[model samples]
Target: MSTQYEALKNADLYSTAFRVEPPTELGERKMTPRRPGFFITRSLSGATDAERAALKTATASQAEAPAANQAPDGSAPAPAAEPASTSRLLVPAQWGLVPHWVKSASDGKLRATKLVHVKSDNVGTSTAFRDAWLNNQRCIVPMQAFITDDYRSGGKPKPTRIARVDGLPMGVAGIWARWQDEDGSELLSYAIITINANAHGLMNRYQAPGSEKSMPAILNEGAYDAWLGSSAAKAKEFLRAYPAQKLLANPVEKGRKNPLGI
Candidate 1:
């Protein structure tokens, strides 16, 4: 293995305690509901087709369950019962984007763990992301909020949670790829696209006091279709910082807890 790859293999930069708070109704965001398979770190495998279909139905049912169980007079139905399973509209996926051509499982695993974020400026040329970017293999990573290090305190950067002021899910730009092993098992992975945020009032304060400012490429509501279908040149134009006025941030205590529970 090359020295750079070896260093990445030794470091556990892929592990993140941050949890994305996905919206309850994905349709409200006008996102395409394609059933793309994704891998979660704990699960380590993609969901089967059957599982994906079932999840879709379960999500819809949960949304209408309240009205379905109500009476015409706005009263609760008799004989209260528990749901079969709690539906989760939001999916938890591994953060890294692994290329399809990795030679071995071990090598793929190492790269996937380390390649969590791809810089927007280099997406078209970086060896790690060029293929996916050139092929328009784009994806939307929806999240209500994400955690980052804030350095305004001047001493040491502190962990801060950032979310949209409107409390809607943020559609972060991303790229995905699939890797199949010799046995035919497959792993689908993704990485968030980030861009320079040095000029933004909100994002510029996120990193260490003087370090370069960076933020995820958050897409606007009407830009979803364009992002997934537009030419590479058009897509590149959308990879910019979200408006500072629309964001909110607060300090957070260090822990693995997901503030927005499923």
Candidate 2:
């Protein structure tokens, strides 16, 4: 291994830019409500059918006149019923996980954006991620690829993109949390789980010089259901580095197009 790679082998440098391309099958699955202004432009994972149906019904109801049960005075109608929860949908949430105890959304945003990845070794005990991990607030972060810094060239390191060789979306292991501000504004966010990659041949090739090498806990296709439904202990068993042989990496020139297409 090159000195640059060795120096950063224990580093914490990792990429947060990931692609979410929801397949057509996801549209048929039920989903939770989408929060306004919470969508990512690069994400292809659009709202689910359930969400669209609820929106259409709400619009139609609002267009109609007040119901006879209401008083003659012009007052607001009864609050709409809350949408029931469903497990079928794969919603696109923010990249970072924010703890529910955060004081303010603004503060939470700042902290969450910096916490895109949580160390698997400490996720179950860390103050910011422990509650979600313990409560089984797990989620699947589907991505086409993720960015990394490859220092294997020996001089200045270049940004590299890594993806599965099979061309399937990577289902990264993650934990999620829901935070709400005093004004009732809410934010749903998540963090990707990462494990030590210093010993992995493919993963040890990326990241800045002198930084710890780490890789996201990329889950196997057959393990998706188990990961989302299993306990923390069972989930931790899956937090291992993806096989080096199954990943492909390509370095991109600076100022050029992002290899992962961002």
- Each model's lDDT: 0.56, 0.56
Question: What TM-score, over all chains together, does every model reach?
Answer: 0.65, 0.67
Q: How many clashing pairs does model 2 include?
A: 9
lDDT value, residue 68 of candidate 2: 18
lDDT of 2 by residue, 118-185 (tens): 88998999999998888887776655566777776788767676767755556678777778788876
Worst 10 residues of 2 by lDDT: 3-12
Q: Candidate 2 has which clashing residue pairs, if any? A: 7-210, 8-210, 8-211, 9-213, 10-212, 11-211, 11-212, 11-213, 97-190
Q: State the displacement of the C-alpha of residue 225, model 1, in Å, after optimal TM-score superposition.
A: 1.2
